[model samples]
Structures are given as C-alpha cells and as structure tokens.
Target: MANRTAMIDVGGGFRAIYGAGVMDRMMEDHVHVDHCYGVSAGSANMVSYISGQHGRSHTFYTQYAFRKEYASFDSYIKNHNYANLDYVYGTLSNHDGENPVDYEAFEKNPTGFTVVACNADDGSTKYFDKSDVSYDNFDIMKASSAVPVACEPYVIDGVPYYDGGIADPIPVQKAIDDGYDRIVVILTRPKDTVREQKKDIGPATILKRTHPEAAEKLMNRYQTYNDEVALAKEYEKDGRVLILAPESMYGLNTLSKSFEGLERMYRAGYAAAAAIPAFLGS
Candidate 1:
C-alpha cells in the first residue's frame, strides 16, 4: 500500500470537527491516517487525535473539545493565565487532567504528527514534529493555532508566532518528506462557485481588530492562497493529493458557528472521508 498522510488546513474558529472527525472516520473506514500535518485549528485536532483526545468511549471530542470547555474561554482561563476573551490556552495539557500528551510518553512512537504555525512578526511558516521534539501537545497547540488577534502567540524558542495557515495552509512538501506517497487534505473553505473580486478591504473586515498587522498580511495572502490552491490542484491532477472537499460547509472561521453546527461538520467529515476510496480508485 502507498504510504499516506493527511494534510489538514486550519480555518481559525471554523475548524471544529472538520479535521478530527474526518480523521476518525478515515480510521474507521480503513483509510487510516498514518501521518497527519495540520495548521491553525488543524493543529488542535492533531493533538486531540494523538491523545485519543476523548474522555470516554463514544465521546469523540464531545466531552471536552466540543463541550462548553472549548466552546468558551471562561472555564479554561481558571487554569491558564495566558487566556483572553478571544484567545485561549492550557486546556489539553492533559486529557481531563490525565493521559497527558507529553513527549516522554509519545515521542518517536506510533503514528506521525506534525503541527505548523506562522511567525507573528515575520509571517513565516514553521513546523514542529511530535517524534523529533521534546515539547508537549499543549506547546504545539499554542503555536499552531495562535492567530494574531484571536489568540496569544506562543513564545516558542523566544519567537512569537501566529496561525501557520498564513504561510503554509497545506504543507504538502513537508508531508512528502515524511514518507507519505499519498496525501489527503481537508479544507474548511468550501469550493468557490463564483470568482471573488479582489477589492481591498480594511483589516477589520478580514481580521479581528486586535491583530492589525497580521490581518493586513492575511488580506495580502489571499492572492498567495490562490497560488497554493493552484499547486494543490496540480497535485490532485497528478494523483499525489486526494482532496476532501467541505461539502456544504458554512462559517469559514468562527467558533460559535463551528460549535453550533458541530454535528453537521462531523457528519460531513464522515461522508468526505468515506469517499477517499472512490477518489483513490478512480
């Protein structure tokens, strides 16, 4: 069988069950995600999947990640000082304060996991590995999903960082190096049915007011995203990438919307992941 890795994209708050749910279905259907690489919210899902990120059987993230715990920053802030009204941290240090996703327990063993984040100051995509690093899942989670305005950036190696999707939405190259001959990517963005006009909008229009600079950078990257999407399409054409579209996906990046519609995304993920065989066989 060809080695495989799923390259999941981060869509800020829009990434509830998109990645994790897709991953679970893939495993259940025998599509087994041998390796996973994710950015932004996708990074959060990686941590959950690696830790069996559930409190009990059939919990499937519902107990913790999907509960009011992750849905709002209120409860999490009691345990973490880094939390803000918009940005949050320190929840997954351990699963229900047990089954910690530490490097000592998880390093260099079992399935592969990689988390990606961007430098807040320079807008660079940096990658972290589960097998290669001594850091815990919480550390990776902070850096991977640290969007400039929405959350506080993790001070990793003394550099401030933000969402990795700004630089590497789909880390296809990294997945290739990780020995996955077949690559699967799940995007929170639905396929565009109509061309979007490239009109300049204020930072507040594209990013939260708190992240002024990164917001400007993100708006500029919309064009850059076009390039990455083109490259992904090329991979699909060559049979190197198997893309799972967000069929009927709404709310591109907002937690409330993602939470409100968790079941929908979960079922959508199941359907999308189930189609992998057809994509591969075709």
Candidate 2:
C-alpha cells in the first residue's frame, strides 16, 4: 500500500519552527503521517512528533534549546545559534525515561522516519533510515544539523558531516519514490520571487575568509529557497502533492522572535488544517 508522507524543509535558526507548528496542529486533527522526511531542524521535529511530544514543541524549543543555561558563551561566538545549548543533547545523551525521545522508539515505531545528513568533505548527502542508523536520535539529528558554520559536523564512523540543507533541503521526490501517494509539505521559507536583493554582508561575507563554497551557499540561500518553492508547485500538478506555505512567518534574521508569539508557529498548521478537508474532497 502507498504511504502518506509529511515533509518539512530546512529553515535555519528558529524559523524552522513553522514546520513544527504545522505538525502539531496536524496531529490534533488526527492527520496520520506514515513517514516523515526532514532536514536540519525538521529532522529534529520529526523525532519529537514520533515520540508524541508534538504539542509541547514550543516549550521544547524555548525552554530547552534556547534556555539561558544551555546557551554557552562559546556557542554564541562559534555557531550563530546555541548549537551547544541543544536540548536533544540532554535527552539523547542521558538516555532516560523523562522524555519520549531516543533511538529505540524511532527505530521501532509504526510510523517511519528518515533524517538527511551531509558529508562535509565530499558534500554528499546521506539519508539515514530510522531503522538503519545505529546512533541515538540526537546523534542522527546532529549529523544533518551541521548548519554550515553555526553547527559543527557530526562525526560518525570517522567522517565529519553537516546539515543536508546545503544540498537537499526537501526530499519530496524521495518520499514519492518511496511510495507515498499523498504528499504534504510545510515550508518555513518564503515563496520564490522573480528577483531577490543581493546581500554582500554578514555570514556569507565573513565566511569567505576560510570556506568560500560554504559562504556561497549562504549568499545564495534565497535562490535555493526559491528553487525549492518552485518545485512544490510543479509537484502539486501531479495530483498527489499539497504544498502548505505558512500564512505568516518571521524572517530568518530575527532569531529570538522567529518562533515567538501565540499565533506565529501554529498558524502554519492551522492554514494547512483548514485546507485538508477540501484537498481530501471529504
């Protein structure tokens, strides 16, 4: 039987929460996702959902990952966000019953999971099947979370890896090939426009000092966003894909407020929830 898939893309910083909000509301309406495919923060989101903590995503992000104690001074200087202040570290590192996260549940759950990771040296993407990866959920997420300079590569089997967003942000085609007939995608990034202003400053600029290619990816991220956005519309014409763009979202620049406010994050799911009945023709 063909499966149903829910996909979320790579939105750096807190902007990725839009996908989480969408997933949370979908659960409330009993939308069953046979498998979830995600990159970067989206990968982390899928683990939380599979573990049944979808509703508490806000608290998880605000209180845990962004907690004052977790965000170390070194984290602020090295990686833009407090990657070291990661809440998953506590959950995955400790391996306790306090949280629903862990590799065991993800590996055994009825709903499938796939986390995307990129090899830093070769720039190759590795898709870790939930049932196949040997590491804990946190480790799997860390592999894909190598957010350029902000995130350190997840070293596994002697290879350093980073976020897959640099290459494959959304794996919609992969989900389709995996036999998912109906596809729903939540995007935290903006829809592609004909023209985007050129940015000559910031991380992309600073990064040129060492890693030029990484800097290029940062500078061209808007183009990447547009390319991914366009692909959704092309896939929708095939009769099985639904693209859910958040009605409102804070820009990626504002890290602190990206997932803030009562309606911002959940709004992504709410908009999609309202569209589902019609999409289903029920």
Candidate 3:
C-alpha cells in the first residue's frame, strides 16, 4: 500500500468551507490517509477529516460560519481581533459532548495527526502532533488558526503562536520529509491563478506601519506558497503528488460571507475531488 498523506493548505476564513467538501468526498470514496497535515483554517478541516466527522465540518461552514459573532467587527474594535476566540473555542469543544472527536484514534493513525503553528516571538514554525503532551489538540488547533491581527495569538506554555500559514502555507515539503510515498494536496484557489503583486495599501499599509513583524510574516507566507506550488508541480510529474483545486472560485475570497458563494465553493471542491481518478484507486 502506498504511504499516502493529505496536505491541506490554509484557506482564508470561510473559504475553508471548500476543504470540507473535498474531505467529505475523499471519505465517501474511502480514500485511506496515513498522515494528515494542515495549517490555519485548514487545521480545523484536518481534525474533521481525521475524525471522520466531515458532516460536522460541513455544518460548521453552512450553519455557523455566517454568525455575526463569529467574526465580529465589534470584537475587533475592542480586542483588536475580529475572530471571537471564546466563541470558536466553545464551538469546537463540543460542549454538548455529542459526537466528540476521537483523539484516541490519532494513536492508531499511521503517521498520526499534525498541525502547524508559527511562534510569534521568534517567527519560527512549530509543529504540534497528537502524540505531544506539551499541548492538547485544542491548543494546537487554536494556535494554528490564530491569524495574526485577525485573531489573537494563542499562548501555550507562556509562549504565543500565530497562524502556521505565516511560516509554511502548504507544507508539501514537510510531508515529503516525512517519507510519504504519495501526497494529495487540497488547494482553495485555482491552480493557475497568479497572486497579485500590487503594492501594500489600506489594511496592509496599516499592518506594515504598526506590526512590521506580522507584515514580514505575511510576506514570507506568500513567498512560501509560491515556492511550494512550484515544488508540487515538479513532484506531480513523477506521480508523487496530486493537487486538487477549483478551476475558478468566482468572486469569492477569503472573507466572503455570502451563502451562495460558500455553497458554490463547496460544490466545486466536491466535484474536483470526485473527478480525480487517483482517488478512485486510493
């Protein structure tokens, strides 16, 4: 059997709804994953995929994503963070105790589950695994999803960490280093889309002036994403990597809250996954 790994990229905000559809289709097709890696919003999707709760992930986007409190401007005004960490934590905690994630299954998983976060102080990447006792799954997930100014850094053992995408967006290199024979990457954007090279303006201008370090990290993330895209293409030739991306995302962006747009992205993701012939065999 091939040692298969899934590398889910950091989809911006509700754009991660697309990843849910990809995961759901993969599960429905019975694609076996030996290892899983994710950063930022992708970490949430990773948890759902590994736990076989893609339905819950779907509900999260379709039902809970549009809540005014989820990404409240009021929270941003008061706390300097648009993301309501408390609300996010409560939702993921499964407070009702119904259909809790099977953390124990991580032990049985081949290469186990891994989430990446960026150390805020040193600007270094941190990889947290289920086997690591230093931080629990929630800590890892929260830290990984903490998107700089959009979401406050999560403190673990007195050290703060932000979104893993700041350091490594799509960690195809990490999966390659881990000895996965084949890797399947789920991308939120179209494969051929070119990143805009416009000068920093508006919020980016403010970020650079106030939080230069955060600005630098964002730049690094962009460079890393481009580099990984090149690497993925090179690996694709050898059948070592397969990438699934939407042909187009219409006008939907990371922060789009339109229900119609979110639904379109979700369906596109599902169709992309289903169209991959490799998945049928896997």
Candidate 4:
C-alpha cells in the first residue's frame, strides 16, 4: 500500500489566535517580547479593551505597549485610517514585562512535536523519533525500491539558508539500528539563503546574479546523497525495507509531488489523511 501525505494549510488567522495573547500585549506601552509581555497581557484587560474598541476606530492606541491598529475589529466604528508606529518592538519591550515562557521545556513535551520550527528564511524542520520512523535520505536508488513498502527517506539541509550540513549521522544510524527502515538527511539549501537576500529588492544587478548559496545547497544535497546511498545499500542486503527518493518525497513541492510519486510506486493505497475531514469536521 502507498502512504498518503497530508498537507494541512493552517491559515494565518489560526496563527494569530494561537499567538493572540502575545500580540495583544506587545501593543501595550513599552511592550517587549524579551521583557515578558506574555504574562502582562493575561493579567491586563486586553480582551476587554479589544472587544470594547471593536467597530470604533481604525487605530486604537491603548496604554503603553498595546496598539490595535488593524482594521477588522473596531469597537466604536469610526473613520478608516492607517497609522504606522516608528518601531513596534521598541514600544512593547520598553513597557511593563513578565517572565518568558520556557520554550525549551515546551519543546521537550509531546505536544511540542506539533509546534513547527520555521527557520528565519522560511526553511523549516520537523522532528521524528527514529525509533518509530525511518525517513528517506534523498538517495534515488534506495528510495526507488522502497516505495512499494511505504518507506520514505528524506532530509532538509539548510544549505544556502544555513550551513548545508547534516546535523549528526550518529543519531540517524542509531535510529536505523533501532529498527527504522529508512533515513532522511536534511541539509540546508542555498536557495533559502538567496531568497532571504532578496527579501528587500534594491538593485536589479544584485537580483540577476546567480546565488552562490543555492549552488552550495545543491552540492551538499549531492554529497549527502552519496553518503546515504552507501549506507542504504549496506542495509538493504540485510533485509530491511526501503523506498522513495528523498528529493522526490520532500522536495520543493513537498506533499503534492511526493504523494503522487508514492502513489505511483505502490498503485494500491490511500493518502495519510484520507479520513481528515472526518476528524476536522470541515
């Protein structure tokens, strides 16, 4: 059977709600993320203030650190005007503060697994317990055969966006030894870093130039593949299952192409979340 991949696009609205308390407090006078605005928002009447301000004004500047300048929720419904603050953080951090959340502890918990870690330039990383999962390592040969068995090896190296090197090969091998059938070796890509460089376009010449960072990413991907291919070959003869090239499975298009490729490989299976709406009630 083929493995179905699920690509859930949690809209930005969802994101805002998830971090609403944090944001509301940041708008208060002298609000600062570093200074623990999170706790202050909880203690303050942020929800009340926002609810009261609904349909009232375009820009509602409340006490220190709290500014609801967005157009949607106006408590008193007034004119539509946009006002940009000099620097949002300067106002928030300099205001009243609180204790910062223990992100490390949060990450260590099982719930933290769902909290994604998106790198600065938009490249992201996901966590997996090698004990339960064997990923694709971007090796074409190993992945080619493993598709029939629903195995995938992959790695996301932050090449140009980062250092373009594998994190630690020991952990990967340990997972395999612990019974994982495949492995994914993530390496950062040059395209990501180049994309970051192009965040603010100033000169056409600079934009036209080939990004050396992207090249480094490609090179690293190739090198990583070479290393993993040898490892996969050694394991395959030992009877462990494998399939699905890393790039084909988790490449630029991610779930889209990977699902199709895996489907083609098995010719008898459904996607991971064929029963998604059953759970989401969407």
Candidate 5:
C-alpha cells in the first residue's frame, strides 16, 4: 500500500489488478521511490539549539522557522502529484542503517561538557574515539534495518576539504570571493562527555585500541574541524565567518569553562538559525 500510494490512482489500481497478473505470465518490473524530505543532518544541531536555547523570544522565533521549513515539505507532497512518487519523509532516520556501536565515554572533557554526538559510519557524529572505531572500517557496523539511503553525496572536486565541519579560512575566503555573501560555520565537539562528571559511552566496544593506523586516521578526522576553524579566523574577513560553538563538553568549551559555560552554544544556535540562510546566501 505504501508503495502503491505513490503512483497515480489509475496507474496504481491498474497495477493492483490486471498489471501484476498479466505480467506474471511473462515478466515483472520493480520500481522504487528515490526522493524524500526531512531535517537535514546539517541542521540537526540547529534544531536542538532552538529547543534548548535560552530566551523565549529566540526559541519561539527559531522554532517557527524550523516548523515553516519542515512543513513546506509536507505541503509540497500534498500539492504535487509526483511528490508521492518520490520518497516523502516521516522521520529523520539518518542513522537508521548502521550497526549499533557502543558510545565510549572515557575521553577527557576539559570543559566538562559534550555538545556533539558521533556514530561509527559517516563521521557525522560529533567526536570519534581512537580506542573504539576508526573512520574507514567503521562502516562494518551499520544497522541492519537502515532505510534505503536516497540522498546523493555533495561533491566538489577542486576543494581540498571533504566531509563536514567548519570550512577552513582559505577555502572559506575563496568561496566568499566567488560570491558567498555571508558564511556561518556550525561547530560541535564529540559526545560521550555530556558533563564534567558524566562520561557517555560510544555505540561500539574496543577490541583493539592500540592500532596506530586506526588511531592516526581517527585523530585526523576529529582534529581537522578545529584546525579549519582556527585557520578560517586567521583570514580576517570581518564577520564573514560566524562560528557556532555549543555549550557542552561535546563542543569547543574547555574543561575549565564548565559545562554551564557552554550555554552560549544554545544562543549561538539560535543566532545561526536566524542567520544561516541569509548568511549563506548573502
């Protein structure tokens, strides 16, 4: 029914009755929906900020924006006949297709806060643990029931950086020079260290933590975001780059700052929500 709901009523009904039976004597064809709408992984942090941020004004405004953007997709499916043929969304199931790895919380949290969450597959999670899993081999643990991934990768050949994090200053400047009017960089630390005293475990266990190759690869992926941020700020482009650091051990706050110190992250998120579209556009 779900699959049939996507086709035109006539087409679907025909398929339900004569099409399948007649084709059964000969051959059958399979069709699949390839498009969908949902909260982008890029915007998850922004959504969390809207929910947890301080100040009712900021929260309400950000929440409204979120609802508007997300709801637009729903409206799109309703008005467009072809939309149902595409994969419309019901949930943010980004991590649905990965093996459940453990989240190890043994890392040092200098700021006593954790703002980012890391999963094994796509370095999408905030932090990676050397002792737990390496970026390359981590795909082995993807969940069995993962939804058929439909989104294509965003690729740029000439640019040196791959994967997400704050764009480094030089590249950022180049992007701006090429006509990116305003740029906002959202930053997050790895999860597992939500607070000073509370250590969160990763999704996987460590069978071998001392592997040098795995450790180096994991460290590079984890450290590059900060390195890019520092490099970006060095370019001196007024406010060309707005850095959104959250108030959690998972973010940029150092241990001395205290988890409470990370409160600014929420505000940063709210500010970014208001600024991202305009910032990215102009």
Candidate 6:
C-alpha cells in the first residue's frame, strides 16, 4: 500500500467550506489517508478528517459557520479582530455542544496528523504534531487558524502564533519530506489562479508598520502559494502529486458569508473529488 497523504491549503473564512465536501467524498471513496497536513481554516477541517467523523465538518460549515457571534464587530473593537477568538476556540474545544471535534479519536488514530502555525515573534513556521503535548489539540487548531489582525494571535507556552498560511500555505514540501509516496493537494482557488498584489491600509497595514519582519513574512505568502503549486506540478508527471482545485469560484471569496455561496462551494468540492484518480489503490 502506498503511503498516501492529503495536504489541505488555507481557504480562509467560509471558503474552507469546500474542503468539507472534498473530505466527505474521500471518505465515501474509502481513500486511505496515511497522513494529513493542514493550515489556517484548513486546520479545522483537518481535525474533523482525522477524527473519522463523517459529515461533522459539513455540519459545522453549513449549520454553524454563519452565526454572527463567530464574527463580532464589538469583538473587533475590543480585541482588534472581528473573529470572536474565544467563541471559535470554545467551539473547536467542543465546549459549545456543536459537533465537537473528537480529539480522543485523533490521538488514538494511527494516521499521522500535523497542524502548521506561524511564529509571531520570528515569522517562522511551526509544525505541531501529535507528539507536541505541550498544548491541547484545539489550541493548535486555533493557532493555525488565527488570522493576523482579523484575529488575535494564539499564545502557546508563552510564544504567540498566527495563521500557518502566512509561512506555508500549501505545505506540499512538508508532505514530501514526510516520505509520503503520493500526495493529494486540496486547493481553494482554481488552478493557475495566482493572487494579485493589493495595497491594504487596514489593521494589517498597522501591523506592517509595527512589525516589519512578520509583515514581510505575510507579504511573501503569495509567492509561497505559487511556489508550492509549481513544486506540486513538477511532481505531477511522475504521479507523485495530484492537485485538486475548484473549477470556478462562482464569486465566492474568503469573506463571503452567504449560505448560498457556501453551499455552492461545498458542492463544487464534492464534484471535484470525482477527479481523484486511482493513485492510491484501494
């Protein structure tokens, strides 16, 4: 059996709803994932996947994601972030009674799982695996999903960490380095769709002025996304890497909150999974 792995990229906000569909289809197809890597919003989905919880991710995205409490303007004023970090943290911690993440299952599963987060102090990448027992699994997930400025950094062991996407969005190299014989990549955007540079004068702008090094790391993530795609493509010819991306965004973006858009993205992801070749034999 090939050591197959899935590397889910940061989809941001509701865009990550799509990944739930992909995971659902993979489960239906009985794709044996030996390992998983996820960053940013992808980290949340990764937890559900590792837990072997069928339809739990889908339920969270469709039924629970739009609650206004998750994104509160009052919280933004008080915490410099619209995301109710506490609420999100509690949800991931399974404290709110919503489809709670099965952390016990995650710990017992033989499949390897790794969540990536960005170091706030040095702008470096941090990989948290099951062996990293210093922090709870939900805390690692929260840290991996913490968007700079949009959400406050999550501090673990006295060190602050932000979105893993800031340092490594796709993290294909990490999967390769882990000795996965074949890698399946799940991307939120369409293939070849590189992000265009834009000037932002929001809280992020303030971050740039205050912490140039960390801001530089954030700015370079665009190139990192592209570079990771290129690396995956280079390996495609030999059948080592398979990339899955949405055929069209359908006007859905990272911040889109419409239920219709979320449903569409989820369906798109389920449909895209039909393209998964028999690279990992059943």
Best by TM-score: 6
TM-score order, best first, reads: 6, 3, 2, 1, 5, 4
Once superposed on the true structure, which residue ranges of model 5 sit more than 4 Å away at CA?
Answer: 1-181, 189-214, 221-223, 236-239, 247-268, 271-282
Clashing pairs in 2: 146-163
The alpha-carbon lDDT assigned to residue 82 of candidate 6 equals 73
Candidate 2, 1-282: lDDT as tens digits? 444555554544466676677667766776667778878777767776776666555555655645544444566575554566244544434456344455565566688878877666665668886765554436767777766666556777787666767656767777878887677776665554332526424755765675565566556655765676677778888767777765455444324543354346556555566665445332
Q: List, residue by residue over 1-282, the lDDT tens digit for candidate 5.
A: 121101000011001111112112111122111110001222222212222212322222223223422224453456322111112111221123121112222122111111122222343423212232232222111110011111112212221111222112113433344443344343343212122211211201120132232223234533444454565565325655544333343222211221222334333334334433333333
TM-score, model 2 to reference? 0.80
- Comparison by TM-score, 1 against 2, better one: 2
Candidate 4 local lDDT, 91-162, one digit each (tens): 221223122122233223231011111121323322222122112111111111111001112223432122
Of the pair 4 and 6, which is ahead by TM-score? Answer: 6
What is the C-alpha lDDT profile of model 1 across 1-282, one tens digit per residue? 544545555544554466666767755665545677867667666655554533221243344555454545664455332223222334345434433454444454466778887776666667887743455336666676655544566677788777676667667767776666677777666644221325425432545454555556566666656666666778888887877766666544454554446666766776777777666444
Which segments of candidate 4 are over 4 A away from where they belong?
Answer: 1-174, 177-215, 244-282
Which of candidates 3 and 5 is the stronger one according to TM-score? 3
Looking at model 5, report the run of 10 residues with the lowest lDDT sum.
5-14
Mind sharing the TM-score for model 1? Answer: 0.75
Q: Per-candidate TM vs. native? A: 0.75, 0.80, 0.87, 0.23, 0.29, 0.91
Report how far off residue 156 is in candidate 4 (Å). Answer: 15
lDDT of 6 at 210: 54
Compared with the true structure, the alpha-carbon lDDT of candidate 1 equals 0.59
Task: Give all candidates' CA lDDT scores.
Answer: 0.59, 0.62, 0.71, 0.22, 0.25, 0.74
Model 1 stretches with alpha carbons more than 4 Å out: 1-6, 51-89, 95-108, 131-137, 177-179, 193-216, 258-260, 277-282
Better of 2 and 4 by lDDT: 2
Global Cα RMSD, each model: 4.7, 3.5, 2.8, 19.2, 21.8, 2.3
On lDDT, the stronger of 1 and 2 is 2
Predicted structure 4, TM vs. truth:
0.23
Error of 6 at 246 (Å): 0.4
Q: For candidate 3, write residues 1-282 as lDDT tens digits.
A: 644555555665777778888888877887666777877777777777776766777777777667766677887887766876556645444434333555555345564677888887767889988665221337777788887667777888898887887778788888888887577777788887655525323344555664566567765566677788788888877777888887777567665567887888888888877654564235
